[model samples]
Target: MFVFWLVQLISKAIYLYTVLLVIYALLSWFPGGYQSSFGRFLAKICEPYLGLFDHLNLSFGPVNFNIAFAIIVLQLASQALVLILNRIAFMF
Candidate 1:
């Protein structure tokens, strides 16, 4: 039961991170948006994770799809974590 609770907690944390990423991306639209204090705070929180996909150049003309890969990776990681936790719980 504790493991299941942990699973849910971790899942929500991942989702919250994803939301933060989205917000950070949206903030990039305005001139000097990311330069604002709030945006900088978000950047500090989001950049480390997002930097993992920096090598990917998935640009379509004006739009950059780099963060999409980051989000997908996060989702995959969350699913994998849930599977692992369930397996561990089953061992008990």
Candidate 2:
């Protein structure tokens, strides 16, 4: 039961993080968006994780494509974690 609750908490946290990522991506469309205090704070929390895919260089002619790739990766990871957590919860 405790493990189940822990899984639920972690899942909620991941969902919130995903939402933040979406907001961060949207904010990037505005001029000097990241220069704002709130934008910087979001970058501080999100950039490192998103940076992991930076080396992939998944971009087009002039566009940097990390945000979309990062979102997809994060969604896949969340689903995988939930599956593993559910399996563990079922065993006990």
Candidate 3:
């Protein structure tokens, strides 16, 4: 049981870390400007995540905020919530 909980926590941590990384990449696009090929590559790789917003016909300053910050924030919150719920479940 403890091992299962540990695995769950680790997975949630990984998920939240990924969410933050995506947020950092998307946020990097606007301020000052993106000068690296890596940034462009990330943008391309992450394009599908942003595509959902495009389907909704929303835009944020030439970029899709719906998929950028919003998605990151939501995913982060979800991961956190799941972790909390798991803890509560274990406690009980």
Index of the highest-TM-score prediction: 1
> On a 0 to 1 TM-score scale, where does candidate 2 land against the true structure?
0.90
9-87: candidate 3 lDDT, tens digit per residue: 7777667656655655565657643446655656665656565556665576866456555566657766677677677
The residue-by-residue lDDT of candidate 2 on 1-92, one tens digit each, is 88788888988998899899889988979999999999999999999999899899988987888988898888898889889988988988
List of clashing residue pairs for candidate 1 = none
lDDT tens digits, residue span 1-92, model 1: 99989999999999999999899989978999998999999999999988888888888999998888888889998999999999999999
Candidate 3 error regions (>4 Å):
1-35, 60-64, 76-92
TM-score each candidate: 0.92, 0.90, 0.42
The reply for model 2, stretches above 4 Å from the true place, is none
Ranked by lDDT, the better of candidates 2 and 3 is 2
Off by over 4 Å in 1: none
Backbone clashes under 3 angstroms, per model: 0, 0, 0
What lDDT is reached at residue 5 by model 2?
A: 88
lDDT for model 3: 0.62
Error of 3 at 31 (Å): 10
Ranking by lDDT: 1, 2, 3
